[model samples]
Target: MTERTPFRARVHAPGAELDVQAYDFESPELIGGDDRARLDAALEAWGRQVGMLITAKTRAVVDVATAPSRIQSFGAFIASAEGPVLWATASSAGGRILYRIPLEEARYWAARMIGAAGDAAGDGAPLTSVERALARQVLTEQLAELQHATGGMFAEPVLEAFGTEPPSSVDRDAQAVVAVIGTLRRNDRRQLAAAIDAELVLQRLGAVAPHQDAAQVRTRIGGHLALAPVEIALRFDPTRVGPDTVLDLAAGDLIPLAHLADRPLVVTLDGEPVLHAAVGGNGERLACVVVSNGDLV
Candidate 1:
């Protein structure tokens, strides 16, 4: 071995074995796919019902989208009948849930209800005395529908407070928001969006204690799951084919299934056979009635 050459020691601190900046472990809770789907359907119903109650001609279609957790600072603002960035906090089993909407959209709806030619530009100004009365009535009706739709998931959600002003103090990084994109149409087009903070929506599903409300919640969840939405796939008989055969198939080629055309189809949920149903039609629509229960596994 030759004599080793001298080396300069590292004057600065050595690089860290683990990159502290890159190490991130915080996983803020979020609703799962099933719950998200359920909420989407419920909110769509809520939007449709609001449209029917507000005006027969004006329709509002809302699409629900998931929003990631974020921090928000509340600031004072004015309220409008249609929407002036309204905020409402409701107490739930997990904690408090916050709902928000833009005032312009709310005003647009109010205008339609009153059959008035409202201004195109709604600045979210405080509604006039008459407008405020109409707006509050509509708001209460919509809120009641929302409470009914979400009754199965959330606790008895009573409207705790409502104002144009944002909360004075809130946790810096606490809110988890869900977005609702709405389209209002009455000859002219208008778009609006609202958000709801559902921090405890998913958590409360499984949080069971001996408390009165908790006990009721648990009982309700057990009964509600049967009504939960599920995909009922209609599967024909399987015909196993080799990879080479699959690769050589073309559009016109027919791969005959193992069963006859009249055979009952296998209805599956989550990839497990749940029922056997015979395929048929019911006046311009495809329909199926259960023939028997399939072996579930």
Candidate 2:
């Protein structure tokens, strides 16, 4: 037993004391790597198709490069561009895309597309009504290509609206959305940046999963059936015999297939004629050389 000093306790007044608790907090789960990869591939395909369509429509060599996407705020992202943009939306995916083109480039593209002379002044002013209409039409074409490229993952894309200021708030965190940046190059000289709001990309990725599975099954079946063998019969001469004559024919009697010795030969698979050929030798072996290919008559 040892003597101890006097003990002292400190207390705080009501509403003046602070209580703190420390614990582990879990982070929100992001889109999985595999899911992200799938989405990326689809996006690249969509971008490629868009480039092809633009090139075909404008007669300009267009190239599109889809960069890796990230999760971020959509509103903040749009505001960062700091210029007028063309905004459009696609169904099913339920997302909008913003396209910003340099005035010179836009005028060039529009002029080339509609076969008109571009404004030479290159003034960075608002697009005239005619220019805006043409831009919307071109953008709508791009949307259609995207719809086809995505294979129903997204429905038709329509030009919803466009302005210097994008939709300030579409969703609570529309500010926090997935962003994919694509660069469209014209004639290897000018480039336009297109920002894709991928808020609905996850939905499109999930929608295509079932279709991908079914396509795999079809591919496997087609592959296996391609190797399946079929019978090919050679015809030399023809001899027609009725049912009663065939029953009475002796074993030594001949039943021919072709009428003439020099006639072109026919090959059949499952009683359906498939090819027309002539008899030929391959390395001292008799082979039916196919001279013409045709479907069954």
Candidate 3:
């Protein structure tokens, strides 16, 4: 110790140690791989339609691409959205979901619509009244494409509202299948993301396959109907009679009907006409020979 002349033996500490991060929390919710893959396929089809719509509307060739999707809470998705974005809210059978595109993208559409310089877009400025009008029109049309794209995923999804600011109606905690859509950007292509309800899609896919054969559906319906019994009525045109004629009805009284002889009569089920038939005999039992058949009303 005497040899250490006025020197301090100090252990230099590396400040306060941060608590070691460990796998201490439950994993976030996510759709399974197979389901996610199926969803992606459906979304890819939708992107193709959108591209066609834009190309048709603008008379310009624009390709649309779908990026690999992400699963996260709507809150996270909304918060992470950078810069000004126009959000179009759509109410579906699942729930109210959001569709978002950068305001710059909206301006791009507006520019093309108004026959302005399409190359000069995204000035990082708010849309004027006229620009907003044009943006709204294109977005409304886009939502129609969304309807066709999702099929029955959304039922009559009327565009409720749209603006640069996020509406308070969105559920913050709801997990979403956020899709990144890339189309006609000022810089060439935009990767705008929109949140779709994961629960809705999973539940729908779990219930029904994306494709169903029409013939198979008809056969299924026919099989079900064959086992069901229904009361059927044969009718010709009604004979108009006074109330006195009804009250004075007698046994074996003849009343002429409007039906012509040898012509097919209307066969009805539950008061709606569904078939044409002619009176006939089947092994001594009276029967109606079906001449034509149709769907029940």
Which candidate has the highest lDDT of all? 3
| Candidate 2 lDDT, 165-231, residue by residue in tens | 4554344244222434344553344444544555466566663343457788997887665555444
Weakest lDDT window of 10 consecutive positions for candidate 1: 72-81
Which model, 1 or 3, shows the larger lDDT?
Answer: 3
lDDT of residue 6 for candidate 3? 33
Give all candidates' CA lDDT scores: 0.54, 0.59, 0.72
lDDT, candidate 3, 1-297, per-residue tens = 445223122222336454434432222435557766777776777677777877766667877789877777788888888878898887767566688888877786777777876676466888999989988887777667666786655454567888988878888888777878788633486666768776766666673345778999997887765545445677886678889988988999988776678668888775888788888887966778888765532
RMSD, one per candidate, in order: 23.1, 29.4, 29.5
1 against 2, candidate with superior lDDT? 2
Q: After superposition, how far is residue 248 of candidate 2 from its true place, in Å?
A: 99
Q: Which candidate leads the pack in TM-score?
A: 3
Count: clashes, candidate 1? 7
Segments in model 1 whose C-alpha atoms lie over 4 Å from true places: 1-29, 56-84, 169-172, 186-199, 207-297
| TM-scores of all predicted structures | 0.45, 0.51, 0.56
Candidate ordering by TM-score (highest first): 3, 2, 1
lDDT of 2 at 295: 59
**What global local distance difference test value does model 2 have?**
0.59
